[model samples]
Target: MGNQRTTTLEARVSLAQDPATTPATLYELCSDPSPEVRAAVAARPEAPAEALRPLTRDRDRTVREAVARNPSSSQANLLRLVGDADRWVRWAVAANPAVDTRIRQQMVKAQDKELRGLLAEMPDLEPDLAAVLIRDVSPEVRERLAAHTEDLDVITALLADRTVRVRKGLAINQRTTAEHRHALAGDSSPDVRAALVRALELDEADLQALVHDRSVEVRRSLATSAVTPQHIRRALESDPDETVAEDARGYQAAGEPRTAHRRPIGKRFPGRRGR
Candidate 1:
């Protein structure tokens, strides 16, 4: 009896995994006694919608999650899976590259903050979706959008966000424009300015503002950042804040290679030292 069941499982598993397995065969496996066979069929990108749709409600979470993760799963099925009781199933829906825009709009209002945050990081998130996340109640979700979205308008809007954490995410985001960096340089929060110093490059005007910033933390970050233009680090050597000056001296003592002294040259010819 054991051997008979094992043989059936092997044959079904093989049938489920076969690239040439017909849709009719895959559909038949959905009702197979083994959950593994159902899950394998669910995960196949070419699995027909009819075969995957029923698996979305499979008693086994793995089978349902495989359907959620399958790009070939239809929007209607994905939308249903997005609300699955299992956290992994919902997350899989958010991470699916083929997730439809309408589904993302629903995700924006999901009670789960992590699920909403995952949607914020989608590479192709439309501006309308980005706008909703910008207004998300959770700072973490907004912060993730601020850090990753390439939408300039979204970045611009987030610059005015009341939450310092959201602005800090914008500070470090490479996609932020020169104007955005310059605007952040004058931010009221010392932490925001400090985060700005960690950017890949800063406008000369922004760098000058940071050089004289009242916050020791901002100046200190500027001093230690390997990308700080050589001349800017020299200016910090005489900073009124002793800690800032000390960090500048320490950066020099480390023999960090020479970097361009101004944005025009630094922007064109970046320093060799890996930051």
Candidate 2:
């Protein structure tokens, strides 16, 4: 093992850049003074459990996070990471599939909403626990769970959630019912309503309602969406907002039929390439 605590930048770069590194070399690099090297080591799927353990308490946040995400990290190392000061590290631990069942149970009731959201993504959470997460205090967790789970009952509740962000997540989910999509059309947030405009299940009536939205941005989304009804797109060609009117004209010029799953257009014009 290299007794040197620190390496030059070149050496550290080699640790990450070199793909052919041996497991023995990776184990030794686990203790490298450069946190990035340690992070790179933790990033390896073949990282040994013994080497991964000590880095769990590494002073650098990235190093700890890397360990939490490493597939080879042992349950004990992951458990320690579960309590890491950084929320993202704990999030990584919760996201790790190999985390112990006991630790997952503890995470189920954790106060941190991000931790709960990541936990909700795991496939094997208890039904009762899943329910608790659906009704979680944090809208982010609610949204995360709605995005991950196929539970219809949960979808129903999430569509009615007080937070627009949560409801928007439900609206964008293809599985959200048409009834739910229509109900969400009345959401106060234009962002939420605009999200509905882009949903695969959006009702024709809902699509029309958005075309007449007070916000030019909302109307722009309609013209931008590949699925905007021909009538609606025609109406937008005469919109007061020049930008929106131009988008309607562009959509018309392209002459593409409204598709149920059209290329998603945002605030920009349909042909306006790049983000």
Candidate 3:
């Protein structure tokens, strides 16, 4: 199902474009006659800016896109890219963290949903703009907000959003309050309840609510997770479904040291962060 050799210019371009590519190889690749090869170099953030300088004026949109996405690209390069004929190039420039703050402020208001989606993940995103995106008509945008924004009130409101996607984002977000997790425990979608139980560091109190969820899948998720409290696991050891009960026994044995139910040491297994 995959090519094994790096013999072609196309194959060479793929290798040179990787972030881990050596600088000397990147320099050689930058001078390749193929714009595709050069585009690959432009995408490497670790590539020298001098190599990237020539690509800013490249005729190919793909090359320009790579330069626009490179975090190490200078403000001048980004400002230059912002005026490119392609909208996605400009979108890429707007999403660049190293770009000027003034430019980024304007980008936050871009009408394009996908562009807005990229802006949603920017670490320096304006607080007011963050609020605006949460209410945006795009559930995808709201989902990103749920994944990124640390604001408690925003996460709380998203829990009750009309769309399941937005609700899912909040359902797994660690910032979700115990109160919110309690409310979400009764969500109509088994997916939502199942997601909450799989979180490695959830409030121990959640087990009480989720153990009685309508979906066997939801109950099985709680039953099988080593993070489930021992008392809850003990109850699940006799679940009506034989497979779920078996899984509970397997989990219960692994859960002996998890008495406190605080996050497991050095483990960061979050609930579903994607659809």
Candidate 4:
């Protein structure tokens, strides 16, 4: 029996290497006692769904994982592996492009927060489903959603989320819109406020308002905001915080030098003129 299994494994490997090997040849090898032969059959592009289906139930997790990774496996086969005992097998299902939106939605709603978070980061994840993840009970899941989805409304909603960490994600999202920016600008947390100030592209009026914010850090940020207008400079000049005022003065001074009238050389030399 040992020699027969070894011979079968070697024959499967040889058949797998031949592009012209028939599906029947590969299918027979898939049932070989050796997991290595089964893995080889699982990887064959021409291996039929029927042949691959049995491997989904293979006793060896490694062989099952290889079956899950195979593009040749039917969607049904992949879905069956979605709840495999091994997390890596489920991860392979999540990573499969052929996994349909319905399956993805189910996975996104999984009881496992880790799986939900992983689904949130998939590039082709449906936007509406991603939006749902924005409200997931787990902060880590919501954080992943905020980091991945580009939907303006979704991000806008996340910006107002009670969780400061979620709001922080919104503040940093590049797709954040003007409305989102305005909302984050009013966030109570200074860290969230600072993140908004750094990431948002506020207009002059908005920038000027932030410059006068009660928080010294917010005011300090506006003093250096590239969008800070000439009028903002005047506003900061009168700011109560001396640091803010100094920054404003430096900004103004860099753009417009202080003029000092020098005594004209000709005026000083008038007595020597036209000798």
lDDT of each: 0.87, 0.77, 0.75, 0.75
Prediction-by-prediction clash tally? 0, 0, 0, 0
Error of 4 at 56 (Å): 1.1
* Candidate 3 lDDT, 11-34, residue by residue in tens: 787778677877767766766777
lDDT of 2 by residue, 61-130 (tens): 9999998988788888887888888998998887776887777877878888778888777665677777
Candidate 1 structure lDDT: 0.87
Residue 57 local lDDT, model 3: 85
TM-score of each: 0.84, 0.67, 0.65, 0.68
For candidate 1, write residues 83-176 as lDDT tens digits.
8999999999987878888798889889999999998888878888888898999999999999899999999999989999999989888988
Better of 2 and 3 by lDDT: 2
Query: Judged by TM-score relative to the true structure, which candidate is superior, 1 or 2?
Result: 1
- Model 3 root mean square deviation, Cα atoms: 12.2
Residue 139 shift from truth in candidate 2, angstroms:
2.6
Locate the minimum summed-lDDT window of 10 residues in model 2: 259-268
Worst 10 residues of 3 by lDDT: 258-267
Write one digit per residue (lDDT tens) for candidate 4, span 1-275. 23545565566577655778777766777778778877887776668887898889999888888887777778889878987888888887777767788778778767877878888777766877877887788998888778677777677677767887888777677777676677778788877776666666775556756876889887776776665566776788768888877666666334667655343476568866643
Q: Rank the candidates by TM-score, best first.
A: 1, 4, 2, 3
